[model samples]
Target: MKDKPWRREQRFYSFSTDLPTRYADMDTERHVNNVAVLTLHAEARSRLHLALFGRDEWLARTHALRPAKLQTDFLEIAHYPGDVAAGVSLVSLDPHQYTLAIGLFQDGACVGLQECRIGHWHEGAWTQLPALLLDRLQRFGLTEDVQ
Candidate 1:
């Protein structure tokens, strides 16, 4: 299988926003605080999830997918008052788990990247993955070979 691109496939659901760095987002050296990166990740992921699974889906599902782990890497520093373009992608799909990637870009350059592993609860416990959600995610462009 071909390796998935570092970026999300265009067909997959995506959410973009201009995230403004606030005073609290800056540190002693006047750069965007490190914690802000995680905030951006959360925003991107939330937007994507809400878009794919509407509010009703959340209320109706017995066990919804939740983030099991997150890994983030920062490539550059962004200062307060600056705005970043954040985007999210569903990159991998499995029977019980899926992977999502998010990117923060400034001035057309990527400054940060994050990947998350998500899992669903089944049979009274959380499992590796769920086939039903995987199939639904595939329609949004996630694939087995994404990793």
Candidate 2:
């Protein structure tokens, strides 16, 4: 499937990290292990959260945003000992819910895509997102020019 065209008009918050694929990340077929994809998704999500909220302590003390679901599609095989760039985009917005779109690119080609749904957890329940949190997320959406 083709990737959705990024809506560049919205402001998207992004961060890039160079990740080295380890030997252990390779499966018997000689490509990066399927399980390793989850680790990359986790790392990307953590970085995006940190960029938006500043730090883990800040999140625990103030923000109610929590990941509710994650889905990933592997478009191509990634080999061990290679570098990958992960780009995250805010694809949709809602008061209580949002979706983050992540693309793992290698050599300028997308190797995988991940979509994460995040929701606010409050008062022992998943509640409608607070205005403050929604405002914070809006800043992470990609700008029209960038998309």
Query: Which candidate has the highest TM-score of all?
Result: 2
Question: What lDDT does the true structure give each of the candidates?
Answer: 0.69, 0.70
Candidate 2: where are CA atoms >4 Å away?
1-14, 57-64, 130-132, 142-147
Reference-based lDDT, residue 115, model 2: 80
Clashes of 1: 5
Using lDDT as the measure, the top candidate is: 2
Q: Tell me each candidate's RMSD, in Å, in order.
A: 4.5, 4.1
Q: Write the per-residue lDDT of candidate 1 for residues 55-144, one digit (tens) a residue.
A: 676445535567788888787787778888887767677677778877788776677778888888666677755454555577778533
Q: What would the per-residue lDDT of candidate 2 be over residues 1-147, giving only the tens digit for each residue?
A: 134544211123266666667888999999887789778876777777777767864467345667898778887788877887777777678877888877776666677777888888888898987665677778766423232
Question: lDDT of candidate 1 vs native?
Answer: 0.69
Per-model TM-score versus the true fold? 0.74, 0.77
What 10-residue stretch in candidate 2 is worst by lDDT?
4-13
